[model samples]
Target: MPPPQTTGIYPSDSITEVAQSLPLDPLGAGSADLLAGDVEYRLHLIIQEAKKFMVNGKRGTLMPEDVEYAMDALNVEPILIPPRPLPLPQFQALTIPSSSSHPQQIYHLPDDEIDFATYLKQPLPAGVANSSGVKWKAHWLAVEGVQPAIKENPNPTQRGASRPQPSSTSLRPQARTQLPQELQLYFTRLTTALVPPSPTGPETEPERHRLAALTSLRTDVAVAGILVYVVKWLGESIQKCLMAPTGTIGQLVDAVEALVGNEGVFLEPYVHILLPPLMSIILTVPLGPHPSSSSSNQPSPYDLRLHASQVLGKVAEKYGRSYPGLVPRLISTLSKSLNSPPFPSPLGASNPPSGRYEGSLLALSCLGKQAVKSTVWGKAGENISRIDDLAGRLYTDGGGKKRNPLIRALIKCLSVIINPKPVDITPQANLDDVSEAFGPNLANMLNKKLWTASEILRLRREELEGEGEGGGVDGMEVDQA
Candidate 1:
């Protein structure tokens, strides 16, 4: 029938191709999609933790140590390698001939049975290809922009190579498919290169090619086996990368965005597998503190949260309506984060706010926008209406005077939720309502104090301005707006 239905990030046949390539088929014959989905789920969790590492460091790059900490957060320990004793060694000198007097007649032992003395005494034989003194002959693979005719370089005398080819055993019905030998070879190499033996070591040329292939595939709308194969390969080894403390998730996220951005691809099959991990990335605490440092020294979850929030918001906008529950879960997650205490306290001194406002604000704004339809919001969109009050409550917190990134995000999200653009009106018609829609309460929130509390933004602005007249803002903070 139709290639079996899959709610996983990869198709069943893609998983089957990978499984069949294995010696023992640990996932068995028909379990490819299930196994693939499970792999993605684990990877999803790893990515969630990876963002924490990014957030904790206050940097854009995901360091190896941060991945290790992400692994720790997931309770996935690294596979410790036990040291093995070196085998007792013995040395022997290899004395190769520096310059043979008879360079053309290099040393050779008699192959055909003859006394060594008699063979040496005999004249060098003619009409035999195996003569030890055979002289070198130069043959160019190509000349004058055209291949020189040689034994191997000549056009095939037959339809293909002269070798007797074995019959093929297909992964699917003969009636259904017949992939070329080159493509089969490519598929094997693609899967192997994507999922290496260990997710450690410097990235090499082959891995780079595999990523390029993945990027190309992500842009395709067709339900190709190769697309599912790459996604499954990524999903399978995600945990290993985290355990190895590798920074590969950055590339992985890029590939994901490519897939999500492809307007041609129908994502209904994959969204369930995709959404939860993205949500985790947005919500997880930044793994900012180093392993050696005292816990109190950890940085704010600023950078990582911002990056994840943008990605999460994008996914919500694209897929929220496809799965109605997505909005509810996103709202719940953001609510928990925003409502968390500002500081832990017998001593009371801690980070200014207990939350990262930017991330919650993003999740709130994007999910609210995408899930506003009556069908997606449930109760004929009553739930979407309630979000305005929740957003407004953030303003009630402690004069809302500390203008961190979070406050900016919260106010912007509130404005959007409270005043979505009217469908009937054009863009030019909206300028007048901007001030009226934001109202006196919002105006007070955005006044001169917002500028003062926005030291991080202002300082960053100055630094970039100093850099050049056409300077761009740095990091994911630029993405907040």
Candidate 2:
């Protein structure tokens, strides 16, 4: 047999083929064998070096980058490979007829070259803005020993600051009493804007500043740090303004509205804290110092009560579904105010004002139709008797000198509760029927619109009953009668 052939992973035939690819003649069998051994040894050495990189990097697999690093470390020229194409081109083979009646097979990766001019003429792909290329930006990691008020920073209320370790001698963690400097500055600006040194003139600098501050409270997302403190301040301010001997509660009402309307700050958790101040404003007997008995023309802070009621309504509308008991609690508080007797100065409280009753009624109306039926028109009709008693008292108190807002509000409540549909045929309103339904004092003050609507609704209900078609008619149509 021929001299025992060397058995190795890389065959001498592959080395011969590689040499044929270059500008050199085909190697002799012995020369090819020797060259293949050297090539095989070099590959083994490079792989052994690459394996070290993989182990150091704590990787199970040796990546191509590791091989490149190995080549650089060993001062060996690395083989250059082009980036992978979308769908990699398949390897193609070509055959050439040789003179010895045998064919030579050649394999290669084919490239389809394009002219530079043609490449330039073609429309380029649209590029996205700031999508490609490396870029960097600087953002605050911390400022003045506190995280900056930025989207990157967590809310102080939610992800609270880490507490410091207690000393070995003590077991309790020290509580932080002072607020952050940023929060202190913000609170000062807000309070100053809301309560200027002098009264805010109409469309003046102070007015603009006040408006701007309210707008910030309504829209700013950075108020989380001072939110609890701000709410506490608002509660105290509202109570003081309502209890003050003089001045309108407009500013306090506006501030409360802004705080409640803020989408950024969650107020539901603090609803208990908020409710007392709002209820006091809505139901307090005298919002400002009792308008002196001599000054009968003084304006009642009735409008302020209406404003507070509106804010209360908003709170209910926003959070009612989440807290199912909210509406009922509000109705209960308002019912107490509406049913309260007018004359007494209950020990510590001032004489109850007529405007308190008006505010209660409007507040009930604000809670929508279902609330009206529940409170104004009760399931057993007990509230109706109570309202009649109230109407009589209000009429007696006014003594026909001026229209008590309470009576006007009661009439409005009656119209709202009835919610009558329009009638085509004109029918006379029998005051006798109205008087029988709602006591004489209330019936006397019923406007023509309310009388017509109530009579039509009553007539419709009677017609439905006569037709034997009712357990309370729908829309209560009375045209046939």
Q: Pick the candidate with the highest lDDT.
A: 2
TM-score of 1: 0.36
Q: Give per-residue CA lDDT, model 1, range 270-364, as digits (tens).
A: 66556655555455333222121233322234444555566667787777777777767877767666555443211112433333445665666
Best by TM-score: 2
CA lDDT of every candidate: 0.48, 0.67
- What is the per-residue lDDT of model 2 for residues 1-481, given as tens digits with 9 covering 90 to 100? 3534666788988887788899997675578777777888999999998887788779999888779877755546777755655576688999988988778999898988999778756654555334675334468876543456677766433343332111121111111123566667787788778655455556899889988999988899877667766776777777766644222366767887898889988777677778898888877765565322233333356666667778988989999999999989999989887766675432223333466787888788778777777777664334655776675664555423145566556555655656464566554566666666555555566545555436534744565566565544633665445
Q: Which stretches of candidate 1 lie above 4 Å from their native place?
A: 1-214, 221-223, 226-229, 232-248, 263-266, 288-303, 342-358, 369-403, 415-481
RMSD of 1: 28.0
Model 1 residue 42 distance off true place after TM-score fit, in angstroms: 25
How many clashes in each structure?
4, 0
